[model samples]
Target: MEAHLRVRAALLLSVLALLSLLARSSSQEIQIVNAERRIDLTSHIVKVFLTLKVENIGASPASEILLAFPPTLIDRLALVKAAATVGKRKKKSYLPLDVNPTELPDAPNGTKYFSISLLNPLSAGESATLEVLYILTHSLEPFPAEISQSESQLVYYRDSAIILSPYHIKQQTTFFKTPSTKLESFTKVEPTNRAGTDLKYGPYENHPPYSFSPIIVHFENNNPFAVVEELVREVEISHWGSLQITEHYILKHAGARHKGVFSRVEYQSKPSFSGVPSFKSLLARLPPRVHSVYYRDEIGNISSSHLRTDPRKSELEIEPRYPLFGGWKASFVIGYGLPLQDFLFESPDGRRYLNFSFGCPLVETVVDKLTIKVVLPEGSKDPSAVVPCSVEQHLETKYSYLDIVGRTVVVLEKINVVPEHNSPFQVYYNFNPIFMLAEPLMLVSVFFLLFIASVAYLHVDPSIRK
Candidate 1:
């Protein structure tokens, strides 16, 4: 009984601490809807929706709210739909305009605010919805908008703003992990503005008499935009010995926005010159101890990339062609052969399973379309993959190479995806052994049948010809 009482005391204290945080945070209520869940490797086409919540504790009604959306996100937005309403929602007249959007505000307040939902009167206890959408066009921000060997450059967030409605908002803390040890009860978090780092933890406010979250990040222009433009991975499994992965990748300087133009002259004459960092090249990482690793591209052999794998460290390095400056592009193709044993995982209890990303690249591109063909061994054809398919508009093609009808061809079409969407697109399919042995057996049977027919026909054909 004494121990039980001690446990109860601890629990009660925890709840009290949480309440304290809620009571003290800026605009203590926040609302957000995440759509990253709707992506897959086997099937494509997707939709992302956002919903917001606001609370009204203030006596006077709230006015305009400003927020920034990254230009990358805007360009990559796929089939977007947006709507805004206040308190059970009485629609308000609103407008959209850029801050430095044109020529007036040279202010560091270079942010965008929602002039929508002016005043439909959000009653004392109500929430609102602020909607917006766009595609994920690209990554790789310019290191320095301009270059000068003499000085360092500063980079700020772009398209980053806040969603304001009233005096306070409540969004549960769910995205990142909390630190193991901390002294403060209320931790600080940087709101997701379309800006650079330097985001803060709380007193981050939200709705009611909505005031924007007061925080920003500034840094000396220095992170290189090391990005891969496109990646295509193909795994061919041969029942006999190998699982071959033939991959093609495109490298680019998604950050080619120069202030004026490239200045090699200015670049050469600097004392420890400081300017925006350009993407001169790229690097590709391969899995452990991959044998016969051949790296090439459509143009030919990519001599610039480096490949290395230490049995101890198990690492591989693949580099790019020329130094990628702002606004340049290139492609690469590489292949690796592995043993089938790599895919087989046996459990302590004797169960079997496979964990793989059915041909999904971490960062995708303007993929107009994609077709994935999975080949099983001889006599193995009936394979069933369940779940993890997203918003697929259609799925009809069913065929393959040299197998009676061909293995199944699954195609997924997705656009406006960024580096963040890469992981979720990788899917895990569950299959049994029957489908594993179909390809090889079918090949041998056809070869032998042809040989038998050839022998029987020789005598009759020769006599008829004479």
Candidate 2:
């Protein structure tokens, strides 16, 4: 009996060993031959572009590549996209690959991973070059946290000097493009150089997997950090040849908080230097043939606005009642009308659809929370929305002019919205042409009844003395 029990235990141990070997073999070992990382700190948004030459070092083929990021940046990351280079050097083309968040088993240092699946598996010792673009929102921090109206706004950005990767890095370099050459300070890794507004680091030697060198740079960046805390865009579709849009914005200066009282006299006198970071006017790009544009706040319509239109596009420049300084906020509304034929179309199967651009129209602005409402015409049914990314969607009901049962409103909500989210989205629904007569017919019937009542009263002569 003892011998049999020992035999069973040995078999179990052997099985465990085989499973471990299989797991290790399945995980491909990769090495980064060369990497170039460019960090753009010219504005409040952080844009990182990475070019990596990767090789599969393991015996097995690599079907996927992993990107690592620290916990601090994972939440702020707004977009991640990667493409692989194909063909020869002069004729090189890029094929976009699928990127999605993934979990790495037994990952150390609380690192987050995003997996990019390759179209073709990379064989052993084979190399491939990849280009990656990612954007982060609200990443720059105001170093002083609070500044007076006259002080130039300076901000701090923290990042790893080394390219963060799960694989071994044979060679890597990082470059920084600052807003200006007025660099207060920056961390110096050996072989770091600064030329004009650009800073370079690395050309470092081989680094083991998961190596990291934290660095920070402090510099003057007085760009307006215009951020919309909450934006609600309402798009109302009318079959009567008009597409109306109204946007409500709660905009704020997301830069350093203001410390002292804002003096308008000082700001106006020295317009060039005083309150350099503050913003008074913002430009919005509207679709072509836009009409009936209005910019207003709670008080009334703002007169300090200009509209320029051409055959292709329209621009609306608006100024708030007061200049927006750091931490200051303003709430306003912008509404416009577009010809229905420009955006609404009817499919062959008798389905009507509306293709509209998503996201805010203001330039270089980030939205913390966005809600888009598409109010279809009354009597529409089976409404659907097609957005590029995931968003919270639900059905709502809104009453408009001469609406009988209220219009079907498709509500889409998303957070951490960037300008890249401005792609076109389609909303399709089944609408009947017969319902178009509901409003006009109702109006005529009411007018006819009124006329008939007037005639009856004239014929009856209901005066008491009659």
Candidate 3:
């Protein structure tokens, strides 16, 4: 009877051990209450916005949360901004977050992790909301990857339908916002929702942590995804003349490349061919006070441009010499003049200030690298500048027409800039009135000296004749 009792006791001990292990596993997993993802697809770039409501179901307080990206987009991901708010409050107070990369064995191949540190440690059963914004470059690949000049371009986009979180998700949804409504085909997951140009996927429930559902979308986007490989914008401030703004762009088509040599005959034979995803023309909006404008390419001035001016605003439309195809390049220069009074302000204390904006490109585009050089007037001192975006600034000397002393050139460099960054920058400096008069005085003095020498030479007749 004692032996039988021992066997039963051992079996009960084994069951208890198994239950303990299961409880520990459940406690270690974080719980996601909700996940909302928004993806905006432009020509070549994709912007992702994710908002997650999470709770720490672990036994200990959680200090960091992990965000995982699919293997395809891991290398192209760029974190823009991230923030978090604690609990449900009438007035939400957001806290800045730090994002760093991490790796987990269970994640898919090429997966990258963004570890966000919480401002306050999330106690067990407590929840926090996180908002993350990021960009993915070259995410949309052409369906054929290469097309003829007369073919319509279709792009293929693939991503995980579910948010790759390292936690149990109670509910989740994804919305895809495209530039056009002409969708050719998309993988239809059940319980999908669609409205206008947006495709909403899921209200998925009871998904285990770290699960992934691959989704592929094909859409007809016959639009030029103009990508400025390089941009050099120069802003010259002059006390006498208008503010001269010039931008030189090396523009390239980010869509699929041509399979064979481009045929001008076929392209012209089809009048509808011009509407394909090719870079044909761009329209830029100029400030109302613009005085002069010009557009030219590397070969020479392009005459196929038009300018329309009104009392309030002006527009400059320009077309390239040839339709830009994938992998082909075109370089062009555009410049305009804006009145000084529009940007420059004078204070009673003789302090000068300037406010100006680098307007968007003529078309929807992305700039890989942008360099802005602002040349201040000669002898300007105590210069201070404020730019809307993050930039690398440096001071240089520039010598221009009739400049006695070199001008102060403020060089600002930025990367991964889009057309939406159309905000004005403020620059304050101290300008002496005497400096403004220096150029005029020098010109007058030179002319007077030349006149006197000319008169003296004329008076001295050819005495060699005697």
User: Candidate 3: deviation at residue 25, Å?
Assistant: 16
Model 3 Cα lDDT, one tens digit per residue, 58-136? 7778787777766667656633567997556787777878877765544456666778888888888898889988887
Candidate 3 global lDDT: 0.80
Q: Global lDDT for candidate 2? A: 0.92
What is the overall TM-score of model 3 with all chains considered together? 0.76
RMSD of each: 17.5, 4.0, 10.2
Q: After superposition, how far is residue 267 of candidate 1 from its true place, in Å?
A: 8.3
Local distance difference test, per candidate? Answer: 0.42, 0.92, 0.80
- TM-score of candidate 1 relative to the true fold: 0.50
Cα misplacement distance, residue 460 of candidate 1 (Å): 6.7
lDDT of 2 by residue, 220-267 (tens): 999999999999999999998999999999999999998888899999
| Best-to-worst ranking by lDDT | 2, 3, 1
User: Per-residue CA lDDT of candidate 1, range 136-227, in tens?
Assistant: 33322334554433444343322212333323344322121111221112223454322122222333332233334332233343334434
Q: Order of candidates by TM-score, top first?
A: 2, 3, 1
Which segments of model 1 are wrong by more than 4 Å? 1-156, 159-210, 213-222, 226-229, 258-276, 310-314, 344-353, 358-401, 412-466
Please, what is the TM-score per model?
0.50, 0.92, 0.76
